[model samples]
Target: MGLCLLISCGESGKRTSVDPGTDTQDISSEESKPVNTPGKKTIVFFGNSLTAGMGLEPEESFPARVQEKIDSLDMDYKVVNAGISGETTAGGESRISWLMRDRVDIFVLELGANDGLRGIPLSETRENLQAIIDTVKNHYPDVKIVLAGMQIPPNMGPEYTAEFREIFPDLARANQAYLIPFLLEDVAGIPELNQADGIHPTVEGQRKVAQNVWEILKPIL
Candidate 1:
């Protein structure tokens, strides 16, 4: 995943992947726009820039793609992309309460990559993530959760990177959350699949990413 995927996840505290990354990634930066039909159960994807689809168009992002997949099944499920570029577990923890305003039937957690890139303490990052989970559970007691795991380059050191990589599975096991082994999966580190930045996935790559997520999300739905 060159600088783009590296930065897309966290980018060593840099916004090089997509300068001035977008704040929230829904169907449109235009909050007023409605991507899903009304009166549907909502599935909220909450995470960082990778979840935000950094450089890709709203419809090309995985969350949006998931929406398309859901619609194709004729399901009345709405996908809400609450992705904030450059967001870390701490950032997500602080904001989880507010974002749960909707009645989320499914809450997909995609945070912590930035914390890994920034080399934040694993314990602290874990705690913040757990806090976010706790908040989500508090809000929606019956909500199904999907945790998206992320990875960083070896430059962060093998021991640290290994520990960082284990965070998601550990959280999933502890919370009984459905785990997506890796968010980027077949997309990360693939030159052609990623945008020029080497971080964010290209449209083709996003299609694969969406499929990766849908496999896990579909079963839950």
Candidate 2:
């Protein structure tokens, strides 16, 4: 897995996926049962370091921001940050079942960047991502999914890059999931918005990231 967690603007690097079953740091909260409450719903955000708030505090993370929004709107959803630092699609595939230890009313899938960065076979990336989706559906048949699309640098090749970018929308349509095209829309590559590593979002960037997610997510909620 070529996970570019260090610098979004520099050379790409790979890393093994963190096992969600064992790695507890990325999880925002823990629940032993199949969900939170009888009336309230649960939204499990499944992604890589980007979702984990790699370079920032858990409070400054987008997931925490989402929690604040939900609180203000008086919504009844508890967001669970099931993000893992340095995770790839395949890693997500392996860890999804564990995260699903609790029910997922909404599953936000933000992955595939590492695959594109690693220049893995597009078909493999697509298949692995599909597998992750399939796993979620297998456990929670009625769970609504929000696929947060990601993009990678063009270092791989224009054709490969284009096809990779197209993967998210394709998956969304095929899976009938909500699409938030380009999760890094206005935040990627912007120096002031990123941490020193240039990959992870700073606190300000995460706030904007929260807005980006909320725009697409609120309607779904």
Candidate 3:
């Protein structure tokens, strides 16, 4: 089982874009305003290598890039990169308590990619993810959750691929979490944006991912 850890960052950079319809933007002009007063709000991203920045620098990862964008927008929130390289949903479920140690205002759950890659039972993956959601909600009822969906390679077989693809939305609805239909979006399958492994994203690819996540994140922020 894989386990992704989240990290906090302090940085700023240019804005990125995601696909239309799913895109979200900020309307507030102020930067770093207190979102809830007194304490700072932290958004934790939970997942595997995709969220862990396996082949990329910590700063180049999508979570960091999103943090930079959020800072620029003046949203008083902290982005925590809790991505564990090679982690599965089962691994994530086991670490929810430690991960949620902080006062997490939101959670961006991005697990199950490795589970799909390893051909783990979809039912098992669903059970693990649902448990993670339940635990997080039980501990932090006010924490907003954003479920990052994934797609498997077509070679995984049509039936399995379809089931794997449907898990994210189903979990999002059941848990009442915000859904980002696909984490890779324009980045995945685009040879230019991906690294040599064809698994992780290039620097440009991560930027595209940040944009992809931002679209759904902006509205919630």
**All candidates: TM-score:** 0.86, 0.86, 0.82
Tell me how far the alpha carbon of residue 98 in candidate 1 is from the true structure, in angstroms, after superposition. Answer: 0.9
RMSD of each: 4.4, 5.1, 10.6
Clashes of each: 7, 1, 14
Write candidate 3's Cα lDDT for 128-193 as tens digits: 999999888888999899999888775568899899999999999887889999888877767888
Give the per-residue Cα lDDT of candidate 2 at 181: 85
lDDT of 1 by residue, 1-221 (tens): 33333544434322223233333222233331224447788888887677677776777778989989999999989888777677777767766766766687888999887777778899999999999999989988999999998888877888998999899999999999999998888888789998877777888988998999998999888
lDDT of 2 by residue, 69-118 (tens): 99999999988877666567777776677777777899998888867777
The segments of candidate 2 whose C-alpha lies over 4 angstroms from its true place after superposition are 1-35
Ranking by TM-score: 1, 2, 3
Q: To one decimal, what is the Cα RMSD in angstroms of model 3 from the true structure?
A: 10.6
Q: After best superposition, candidate 1 residue 213: deviation in angstroms? A: 0.1
Q: Give candidate 3's error at residue 116 in angstroms.
A: 0.9
